[model samples]
Target: MGGFKATLINEIEKLYKKKKIIVAAALALIFIIVGQLATIALRNGFGVRTVGSMEFPILVLSVVANTIIPLFAALITIDSFSGEFSQNTMKISLTRPVTRFKFFTAKLTAIILFVFLNLMFVMVFSVLAGLIFNSNTLTAYGIIRIFISYIVTIFPMIILVMMIIFFSNLINSGIGVFFLSIIVFLGFKVLGILFSDYSGIFFTSMLDWYNLWIMSVFPFIKILREFLLLCSYGIILFTGGFYLFDKKNF
Candidate 1:
């Protein structure tokens, strides 16, 4: 436990030193501000009805998942292994008493924590942006639902982080990992669309987890199915990455 804590702290400090967290927060805020501005322009300039405060965060989240969140996920996880390998930090860290599994777990935990923090920041900023721009009344139930949606989103986000981490371990270049992860992340969505008939079998379709909240009539079974699909993929990818890391020659 102590070793894991130390490793987690070290990973977080590295992120802080690199200003990755700061950059994530900045980018999230910028994305929210721009989205709100666009919403306002459409409402006032083009006479469109903007989404209500209750719905605004969901709308922003949909856009973020497609754009900002993927980029942020790639940026954070791209370095999980490739950066360590490139800088020879992995060798030094392995020389410690920590096992490769623990090191990998710590890195994965740090990136998940970072991504969760980034998502929370986005949620908060979206609410603030809505309050400033939208005239819809905010109800406690609405706020609770939004928060729940954010919590549900963590599952898909973890799947994405794991995919990037897997690729990072497979590839030795940080830039290569970054671009490839982004490409695969976005590519999955396109493939999901192209094969909409098999979206149920495709884990990438789970990226639209937000729809679980927006369903006019809640489909509990479908939601559970999608959640399970994501969890299965996450487990498989993470296990594969760990196996590769454990066996790889540094």
Candidate 2:
């Protein structure tokens, strides 16, 4: 356990040295701020009704998910493995007195933690934006609902990160992982809808924020169930990524 902790610390240090966390944080801040600005515009400008209701929050969240969250997740994890391999540091990383599984898991854990923190920042900023745009007494339920809503908004992006990490190990380049992640996400949505005839309740349903918002469907129970399914998918992909990394000739 001590060894694993040491390895985790080392991986974190390496990440910091590369300014990966800093870059991710900066992007998160930018997205949150942009989301706030866009929300203000939507509420105040264009003669639209700025009623302090669930509709406003949902619209704002859709904007964030569609614009901000996707870019941040992609840039943060796009180079998950290729960055190491390209720099020829994979050899040094494997030389550490730690199991391959632990090393990969540590880095992935860091990225997920980063994503969660980014989500919190976005939620807080959105609330502040809400207050500034219109003076509504933020109710307890409102606060809780929007938080759940925004996190749920980013659920598909999180799954894409897992896919990126897994394929980053399989391919020789990070670009492949990045593009493949996008293709799988958007392509699956199209194919799932056009071919499989699957309903919007499935994981693919979450891919299109516009559809989710227009449907006016905030099925909390269903969202919770989908979140569990996403976590399960994440665990499976993470395990596969680890296995590939462990056996790869790197």
- For model 1, what is the error of residue 97's alpha carbon versus the real structure, in angstroms, after optimal superposition? 2.1
Q: How close is every model to the real structure, measured as TM-score?
A: 0.93, 0.77
lDDT by residue for model 2 (156-196), tens:
66666677788878887777777787777677667777866
Candidate that scores best on lDDT: 1
Candidate 1 per-residue C-alpha lDDT over 38-127 given as tens digits, one digit per residue, 9 for 90 to 100: 888998999998788778898877777667776877787776578778888888888877878888999999888887877788899899
lDDT of 1 at 33: 86
RMSD of each: 1.7, 4.0
Residue-pair clash count for candidate 1: 0
lDDT of 2: 0.66
Which residue runs does candidate 2 get wrong by more than 4 Å?
A: 16-46, 51-58, 151-157, 192-204, 207-228
